[model samples]
Target: MRLRGRKGIRETIESQHDLVVLNPAEWKGRWAERFGNEKPIHVELGMGKGKFISEMSVLHPDCNFIGVDMYDELIRRASEKARAAAGREDGSAPDNLALALFNIERIADVFDEGELRRIYLNFSDPWPKKRHARRRLTHAGFVRQYVRLLDSRGEIHFKTDSRPLFEFSLNSFADLNIRLRRISLDLHKDGPAPDNVMTEYESKFYEQQMPIYRLEAVIGQEALAEHEASLALAERQP
Candidate 1:
């Protein structure tokens, strides 16, 4: 669903600097300063078209939200959506929301250790081929990186329509012995949860009678210790 050849997409994203972060690395460890508050920061990796993040920002004014995606067109679209949600015609975003164009693999470069309070992975690419498993957002390597950026009470909330991806993610987290909770194999079986925010893809999937899977990975001290031990063992092996 990558958009290409969109005229002026880059210009549009740059024009809304208030909503789009062009140099996120500079904001590392200072996200609160960027938001002008000390509220917890929540990030949605691979945020597509920005429906959920924008809505969440409006709903939770006490928290700051950052939507990260690599595509210029998608960032531009999200900026527009953020502005529309805030009812601003002058291209301003909601005070708590910001969109950024960056590669998810290099996320650690933009946020300092324990900087993020929550991370969201909604309908992420499954990367179905077995050989491409490491590219999955929930891969153990990526999970380790996420663990480094999360505070002691931080959490990673993941949702997907692909069952295989869900299973793979479950195994990945288990390997690290990370604590998980609120796991749902069929998220909308009894209708959407009261606090759930649906992304555009999720909304379409729901209408098509697709089941969504979700889980919350908590970063507890014991789990962090195990993760560090595993990394140490790997280094020793090599």
Candidate 2:
């Protein structure tokens, strides 16, 4: 079933010069001088409905952004937002944003190694089952992917309300030798970071009196941690 709820879903995503690939096989090493803004690239993994990156891309004019998600329906909406951005008068102010339909597990293949300056891991699945811990985006397996695509100085900004997931991510960072910085177990206690991007799930979590946990981890090498359990829920089939 196609996920619904964007104003412009029917418009074409690709220009005459390129193809909007829906399959993961076509995604590897594709990013280049493709966007209008030539500055460093920032990306969001699991960009649901294009809310966070779309707003962030609009706000930050100088930096380019690419949002990667596996859902074709979601990318279609994200593409529409990019097409809308193309006509803006200011060049630095997000003349465009890019979208791709690919799995997060294929992070390195999605772009050339060390190509991304920053990554946003917003409300990724907790995968609560002990057996499924390996599937979490912050898990050792996923961290390896991030390590490959992220620049040496690049950081992964994460936000989640799940205590288990937060603890797991911190442990993953430590075990993997990933540099943990700007640590925040609670987002509301300290002043909200000016650059933080909020997703739809984040807003819902806020309204439910959940304490939002946020952190920044830089790429590094550390021993991987052992998973206590696997995700009990069925993985969302792509």
Clashes of each: 0, 13
Query: Compared with the true structure, what per-residue lDDT tens digits does model 2 show for residues 1-238?
Result: 3576555443444331232445534544545556633477788898887778888877787887878888766777665555455545542224446676787777666677877778899998899999998889999888877778776556788999888999999998899776666687778654444667678788777667678998888562321111111122324334
The list of candidate 2 runs beyond 4 A from truth reads: 1-30, 36-38, 80-94, 190-193, 220-238
- What lDDT tens digits, residue by residue, belong to model 1 across residues 40-76? 9999999999999999999999999999999888898
Q: What local distance difference test score does each model get?
A: 0.90, 0.70
The best candidate by lDDT is 1
Compare the candidates by TM-score and give the number of the best one.
Answer: 1
Once superposed on the true structure, which residue ranges of model 1 sit more than 4 Å away at CA?
Answer: 89-91, 220-238
Q: What's model 2's overall lDDT? A: 0.70
- Ten-residue stretch with the least lDDT total in model 1: 220-229
By TM-score, how accurate is candidate 1? 0.90
Which pairs of residues clash in candidate 1, taking residues 3 or more apart in a chain or in different chains?
none
